[model samples]
Target: MSIRAVDLFCGAGGLTYGLQEAGIDVRAGFDIESECRHPYTENNSDVDFVEGDLSDDVSNAEIEEYLSAGEDDYTLIAGCAPCQPYSTMSNGNKNRTEDHEKWGLMDEFAEIVADIQPDLVTMENVPQVQKHDPYDDFCRRLAEAGYHISDRVVDCPNYGVPQQRKRMVLLASKHGRIELQDPTHDPDEVTVESEFSKHNFCELEAGETSDDDFLHNARGLSDTNKKRIRHSQPGGTWKDWPEELLLKCHKKDSGRKYIAPYGRMEWNKPAPTITTQFYNYGSGRFGHPEEDRAISVREGATLQTFPSDYSFVQSEEELSVKSVGKLIGNAVPVRLAEAIGQSLIQHIRNEDPQTQLQTV
Candidate 1:
């Protein structure tokens, strides 16, 4: 049987593109952000990009239509609901209560899975998601629908993503037991230098853009910050700076342990988690190892394992560092998604010997 899929909450088609790379026919992707349409449709031409809020009944119905388009297809519904409410980064924030609005998106995803009863389903989210009641509810509903469920937190570097991202992945199949594939890469073998060196990006100074690659543009840095990065050693913290360069906040005991800000990444290790603010030098450990600026938009996407040539916008005028960074940082690392796709295909083939699935 042919395998057909729909990706919900598909931001810039990262998951959809990865599944497609593994030979799944991902027919459609739905997201609320219209900004995603260009990248999603431009890259994955075969997949229809539907811009809408997935919480609406009409959206769910539209998803159902995509799944049913091919009668002989083995249907799959996959999604990674917006994870801010369940992310560890948001854990200690005072405004977490206000973030509850997104807590229901997972429930909406579950409702669709329960109603559609697709042959296979998968979801990827921050590891903290397991602690929430919505996660338990989502799993319970899948079990009630007769799915064989398996889930665990996975390190992205083990799957060849050049970042230190840990995500919770869940796989559910109606066709007997299913699980993610074992790590395909040795974490040590997937390093920042190994990946970024391959790109050989044109040398760019702070606030400069590559003439050849538009996305390879670095955010501007203040003069003080420039001197700070000049003194910053790879994998070294702000504590390494001279006394005068230290910020008042860093001088305090409370901020002593917070070493990620203004730190440069180590060449031999995976990069720190790519947050939406990665383009800003002061955000986390986002500064380049030798360059006097934060990682460029293209570099951030590379760390997320997006193909080097993946287009984020149609033209240079449309590019916004903040917007593009959010899309790239929030994306499911494409390599990790491809691994999930492989496992699902293998599970289907194992259950039905007559099925033939291909991978790119």
Candidate 2:
């Protein structure tokens, strides 16, 4: 009676990892990028990683082979199609049409769900995607397929993730009504003290190590940027920079409203949404609270709710800041996904007390 799951568009197995953590049997992950193969397989052993573009035709035989591999009575199909096309960040750009090719991926996901008709279905994406026509079409299709659907934009911090991120989550069940559970943490509850005070080395200086092998690394800073962060305070924006260090863009009216870049995260609060360029101090508020450099790969993974030892870059030659940054930032926060998995578990148990999932 345990649910068997196949993750579509699974990046670095964040959702798969969380599902496994929540007692679901995640059998495989499907992704287009060849880079995901190593990390996905390495982190979640025994789960097959299928590398193929979802936008193209993904045959039912391929998905069924993985899903049916397990002897479970219930099945779950989860996908978080690429959200860049429907992102508000791309809203006003004239070249938005250029991303039209990617928008069809949602439709592709819908098509698969309709064809498979799994016992349960779930999807997570940027909140902005909620307003798009494709999402509406997807929901309508699910309704037509007789799904009991529930969905809402969820704040990540509410689910115990120590980051300010908002994502739209959708849950649909053919068995019964199900919705995500209420918030586990109050908005005012997550503080710098709660997240950082445990280590004793709360104030990490640039290139400083807490002597913990896993957290011993961070992105190094240039000498000039190092001096800039020295002037930057916790939770303070780039505007706090000394007048002598002002960049050319900062003087412009358009750039004044964008203050997160080069800003330092406050220790007592949830970090800002981690992004693909998070390794660069110039991108968003990535600077370590007391350090002169941007957060390290380990710190980025930590903020994303990845376990301390979760491997993103496997080999020394494959270790590039940009590639690993994308994998971490684009990951479904593990804590949030665990909450979703817990909800599904509860829903299944409520609907059928006699049916118990087999544990791996």
Candidate 3:
């Protein structure tokens, strides 16, 4: 029997890569946009990429056409619906709009599961999404459908991604009970230095591209921020700055007077959260530890924990570091995806990689 999955809202194949690496035969990806097709299909030849508006007019018949015809296909349906609504940082109350998450994509997923009756199911999304009623309702619907559902919020670094990112993850299965993976790394117990020191990063330049696009890709800081970072120390905050460099906003009482703003990353600790504008040091403590520039495309990718050798295919003329940088920073780190995939695979079948590696 083949292990099968369908990645919904697949963005540039991050989760697709991880699941494939773990021997899951992801059949095809469904997305609303056409851009995702190129990188997703090009890199993941073993999988198909289907483009469509999954939240609208998409039907159970459309989803069933891809599932097993007769044999025990061990079907898995998975998606991370567009989560702009739940993010605390979204520009406005965009989550209020209809036809997106508002139309209940999770409910749509549940409806599909009930119809096709896949053996396993999963979803990954921003941590804020867990606070919404829809997520709880979706889980309830899954339980009513005779599936063992498990859900929880997780910190990405715990799964070996270098950045500090939290996510909501859920796994449901008809095969048996479902469970989320345990933390791979501890915060109080695991420092940032301990995460990447073992890897052979010495040959890697301070700012360079990795085969895997998600490693590190902070935008080059502006000249002004560059000058500021040149003087900034790792693990230190704005107080360390001289009076000449203080922004007028900080001089005002309303300024956030916090160390994270315009701060450099400390090598000994996990990176601050990887935000959409993570490339810009001004957004948070995203400045490079020893260099004058902001985090490079590769460094940000590293912070995301995509393996150094993982390939992100782009045309020669298309390496606009900025565009790819956003893709990587905004992407689910492939390793985090790997951990999720591996966890789900093990949970569904008692197939722990650690134990398998020991035997091999």
**Which predicted model would earn the best TM-score?**
1
Candidate 1: worst-modelled 10 consecutive residues by lDDT: 53-62
Write down the worst ten-residue block by lDDT for model 2.
195-204
In order, the Cα lDDT scores of the candidates are 0.90, 0.82, 0.69
Model 2 root-mean-square deviation:
2.3
lDDT of 3 by residue, 1-360 (tens): 556778877877788877877777787888776667776887675777788777575666777677754464567787777677667765255645433443467666667777878888888888877777777788888888888878888877677766667888888888677687787766654444665565554333334444544344344445566567777999788777777887888778878465687888888778887765667777788777766656665556666765655455455355655556556666667777877777766774574323322100
All-Cα superposition RMSD per candidate? 1.3, 2.3, 4.4
Candidates in order, TM-scores: namely 0.97, 0.93, 0.83
lDDT, residue 61, candidate 2: 71
lDDT (10s digit) by residue, model 2, range 1-360: 578889999999899898888888888899998788888999996899888876565686789777774454788999789888877677777488456678899988998999888889999999988878899999999999999999989988898888888999999999889999899888676654465553333345566545554343566677889878888888887777788888888899998888888988888789999888887787888888776778777777877888877887765556776788888888998988988898888888888887766655
Q: lDDT per residue, candidate 1, 1-360, as tens digits?
A: 567899999998899988988888899899999889988999885789888877863456778889885465688999899999988777778488346788899999999999989999999999999998999999999999999999999999999998988999999999999989999999998989989987979778999999889999999999999999999999999878999999998888998889999999999999999999899999889999887899999999999889899999998998987888889988999999999999999998899888665443
Indicate the residue-level lDDT of 118 in model 3.
Answer: 84
Backbone Cα, N, C clashes tallied per candidate:
0, 6, 16
Task: Compute the lDDT for candidate 2.
Answer: 0.82
